[model samples]
Target: MRQSGTVGFWRWRRNPLKRRSDVVEAWVLLIVAVLMLCGLPLAGVLAGLHVDDELQHQREERQRTTAVLAEDARAWQAGRYARYQATVRWKASDGTEHTAVADVGPESRAGSTTSIWTDGKGELTGEPPTEAQAASAAALAGVLTMGGAGALVLGAHWVVRLSLDRHRAVALDQEWARVGPQWGTRHA
Candidate 1:
């Protein structure tokens, strides 16, 4: 009962048995706990906000336009994207026309219409992510930020633990140096 109840007694109680290293380590553990609980979530929130802002900027800058395949293009893969590739032509805001290779679906054929995305220069580009995609990306960013912050704090805690252990070892060596000589003069 005594051993189980005294688990953290050295850290929580004031006694001659509590060395300076013990006190420092206890304070460090408390700080780490606070940071892991508070700072990690804060980092995740900040990262999510940042991702949303960037996605919004992209949504504002990119434009969707109608394009036509210059020739029949077959499916490059059976997936949603890159189902096919073909020379696609679209008009710019100034009525200038441009051509670029584009990913299309199997339904595309010569002279058939399809929607495409373009940049400020009217060059073909990938479409901006939908609201769902933006939200998913934000969520992923938040998770990654939290994980990275946790890893950093955990590493710092490990370093602090190692430093405290080294100090404890040095203290033990010093104490033994003073008491070691007394053992030679003892009768027993």
Candidate 2:
């Protein structure tokens, strides 16, 4: 029921009741605050940049190639997104012909031309991420990495705080053991 008074003033106030643990906890909090402020955003940005570079590399590897349909795709379906898998043929940069199954609109027919992505080996591959997609992916990666950094920082803080609490408890126990037997010695 005592007055708790001001918040962070515990670190500055001259009070005999303040233990070593209180000062250490305050210092730990200050260090953690500084680190979190600098570390989290930096980690996020660095991770995003690294991921963006990787995405760019992948985009470079994937190139758009015009392929002719080797076989007719199914007739157009009523759904908005109605694509089916069918065979396609394309010539590689080395003038080598390759055939692979690709996703195409249902309305596409055999001998029709369609553009698809191919790797350097002329193998069909998924399309590369666009600019907006890359940005989104980078943001997601940044957020995920930032969360990981936060967890690591918080975990360290928890360990330090627990250690301080344990030390405080041991000190309290030692003090009480030394002074506990003097309670009834007022007349002695």
Candidate 3:
């Protein structure tokens, strides 16, 4: 009698009808399982560590300093956000003066003092991320990396499965062609 349900480990068991393609497919599934369980998480952790290190380095290189607005800071609307832009001047660690246009508080006016971040060259730069922000960024990086890797692995597995299916279909068709004539003659 024909089996109504699938047999467990049929691919690995010694069956007369089992083809080489079945063995290959079973091995593919095993490898995919291993990668999903172990390899993907390792890649995610490495990616997160790399992002955290880079962010920490950037935070270390940034310097906070007080600057005086050289011109009145005019508030402007940008989409859902509001900002005040004005020219500001500050002295660098080398005692050289630098002037640039930057964003300031809405209440800031000419000659008002404000805090700003600068790079080692005394060029105005955005403030680096805080510890919390860096941690969040690292976590986001890790999750995204894991998601991307998982997608790639699953896609590859799908392709392999599709190819195996097609191969099995062709083999079945060839076998049917070879045996069908004999059965027809016996029936006649």
| Top-scoring candidate (TM-score) | 3
What digit string (tens of lDDT, one per residue) describes model 3 on residues 26-129?
Answer: 99999999999998999899999999999998899889999999989887666658888899999999999999989898889999999999998899999999
Q: Give lDDT: candidate 3, residue 131.
A: 99
Off by over 4 Å in 3: 1-8, 78-81, 94-97, 185-188
Top-lDDT candidate index: 3
TM-score of each: 0.77, 0.73, 0.84
For 18-108, candidate 1 gives per-residue lDDT tens digits of 7888888889999999999999999999999999999988888899999989988876776655568888899998899999888877777
lDDT of each: 0.88, 0.88, 0.93
lDDT of 2 by residue, 47-146 (tens): 9999999888878988999999989886344476765867899999989999988888777889999999988687888999998899999999999999
Candidate 2, residue 12: the lDDT equals 61
Q: For candidate 2, what's the RMSD?
A: 4.8
Worst 10-residue lDDT window, candidate 1: 74-83
Winner of 1 and 3 under TM-score: 3
